[model samples]
Target: MSYDLLLTGAEQGDVAVRDGLIAAVGPGLPRDARQVVDVSGRLVAPGLIDLHTHVGPGYWSIDPDPIAWFSGVTTWVDAGSAGAYTWGGLRRVATESAVRVPALLNISAVGLAGRTGENRDLANCDTALAIDTIQANRDLFHGIKVRIDAEVVGVNGVEPLRRGLAAAEACKVPVMVHIGAAPPAVDEVLDLLRPGDIVTHCASGIASPLGPAVRSAAERGVLLDLGHGSGGFAFDVLEAQLDAGLRPHTVSTDLHARSVFGPVFDLPTTMAKLLAVGVPLADVLTAVTKNPADALGLPGGTLTVGAPADLAIFEVRAEQFSVTDAHRQTRTSPIRLVNEATYVGGRLLSPRLPAPPAPWVPLTRAQHAALTRRERHIRDLLATPLVDVDGLAEQFPRTKPRSS
Candidate 1:
């Protein structure tokens, strides 16, 4: 009866949202609601949760909220962007950020800041230091992540993973391993991982492909994740596996600056790719929502009453679109899912690329002052209406925001 908002989705009746939670899902939700979002004919589901993202202004990362929320991703997990040495920056973001951001601490001590061989030096796999870091920051970190590519492992091979698994064991959490590059091939990598441990980038195109070992691991309960990053995903790998019924348990874009430009433009784009490649829409939705939340130990990928009102409304367009992968492979599909609106705990967030100017409805002085009081940064940004010279210089040493 009394609620803040009401929403309607395809195959589902009117749903009521009240006090930052799903109040009910049925026909004729009360007309006394404060806001009504008639998303009828579209897909209304819990906000998407990205299991792997390199999110931040820090190294190997990018500003997660703007890129993530625009594409219907509400929760993001940073995969091995920070280690013991560089964990502070990410932790700070997680604490202050409105979106849910849990991370997998890197096994390497220096993190991904340096040139790519983070685990090349065997000494960097400091389980004790990693344990200390996890022990200190229990809220920020949920598990361990290690990239076992030949370049990352160097001569050490699977030792880094062994140590990383030990650290995860020490912290009593899950482990996510990135497979590619060899010496310690796919089978060897899967051998180190436990039942619940995650194997990211599962649709990798390589000589070994998804052999008996990978299928066996999945049969035994290991979670497969389609972490579609650069050189990590391929059309062939995904199609064969799907045809053979080796479906990935979760879908996540290895979202970072590089992948954001193409192949992995955003989460919806990746989901669209799966649908194009023959995955059922419902299964694709589950891969991005519930399955990820369950795997990452996060919350709110459901529309249950009293649950967090983190929801995403998507406009499913039946038109021609192109989906590409890291290997320059493309699959043209007839459907695309575009994000229409995102709700975070029932609060509507303003997007970065806002709608075209709407006659410039001026805000009253009192309203402006109150908004300024609530959001100081927006006030400052609009007041200047240009740039923050000093702040920009501080953040970007390589390129100045201004000539001076």
Candidate 2:
């Protein structure tokens, strides 16, 4: 049968799409499609599912489509950027985004309107409210999120997490907890997580969750997420976790307004950082694609027939690339996954320029200059004529002055 689109010559074999789903994927699929793209020497994998990100109406939120088109991240889970009170705004953003955006509703009703302290006011961590919100918006909210940090939770300690878990239990959804610097010890937070719960920033340098509690949590089926946000990841911490047989179950860039520019540029870059740390390419890909999908119970992580045709094509360049973690420390990766094209539901995603960073977001001078240079370049390109006079074809040619 003729397909709607066919992608040939990829490492994973030819992929055929029909009705916005994968029709077939195998060696030398028949070139029977309305549109056939020869993607020789490229690696075509399932569109990446970023398990954690902020692309909602909040302090940290950024437009996901501009990054999604080139970065191959078709699914962006807005991790706790919205709570019950602010869910409507986030829902609107999710509805309008070209990429899929499932979210983890914050336990606090205030949400992330500011950088932190969503859970500081214990009054906002209403379990009943959270449960009701999840019940009402099950289509958009997949789970619950609670930040267990010193500054975020304040004197409340793990009370917010407890409430989040209570809500999650009621809804039968998992809870993804963000861990950071602790006033309440890390163990206090880790001990309470139930099976299937996620511990984002599991290898945080600040929290340094390299303890028996963390190991026990993993044994009990709590998933670890490499939420490499502005200050979540540390090379030393991750390496230690690997040594201790506590590898992250999933890797996600907690991509937000603050971390989008550096450290956690995009999902592929975050994957490359794992590669630099000695994780196999297959494992890295699984973490970004399959593991994340499973973690959140979202779709589009495989090329199987009938799955959503969300895929990413990459030119895997074999070279030493210097990759950095949230900290300034850097490591060398032997390969780089450079995305050439991205597709969502069999439709090619159009290129979109990112909007300028929010004024409040801090940027290094170099980053600031780079953004300026990029804007100027785009302006120049658009300002130039599409084609010279010689390249134009005359649709209405005058013939002998109309024989007058």
The lDDT leader among the candidates is: 2
lDDT of 1 by residue, 239-261 (tens): 88887789989999998756665
Q: Cα miss at 322, model 2 (Å)?
A: 1.0
Global local distance difference test of model 2: 0.94
lDDT by residue for model 2 over 1-404, one digit each (tens)?
A: 89999999877788999999999988888888999999989889999999999998879999999999999999999999999999999999999999999999999998999998989898899999999999999999999999998999888999999999999999999999999997889999999999999999998999999999999999999999999999999999999999999999999999999999998999999999999999999999999999989887898899999999999999999999999988898999999999999999999999999989999999999999999999999999999998999999999996765545
Model 2: residues with Cα > 4 Å off, grouped in runs: 389-391, 400-404
Worst 10-residue lDDT window, candidate 1: 353-362
Residue-pair clashes, model 2: 0
lDDT of 2 at 8: 91
Each model's lDDT: 0.82, 0.94
Say which candidate scores most in TM-score.
2
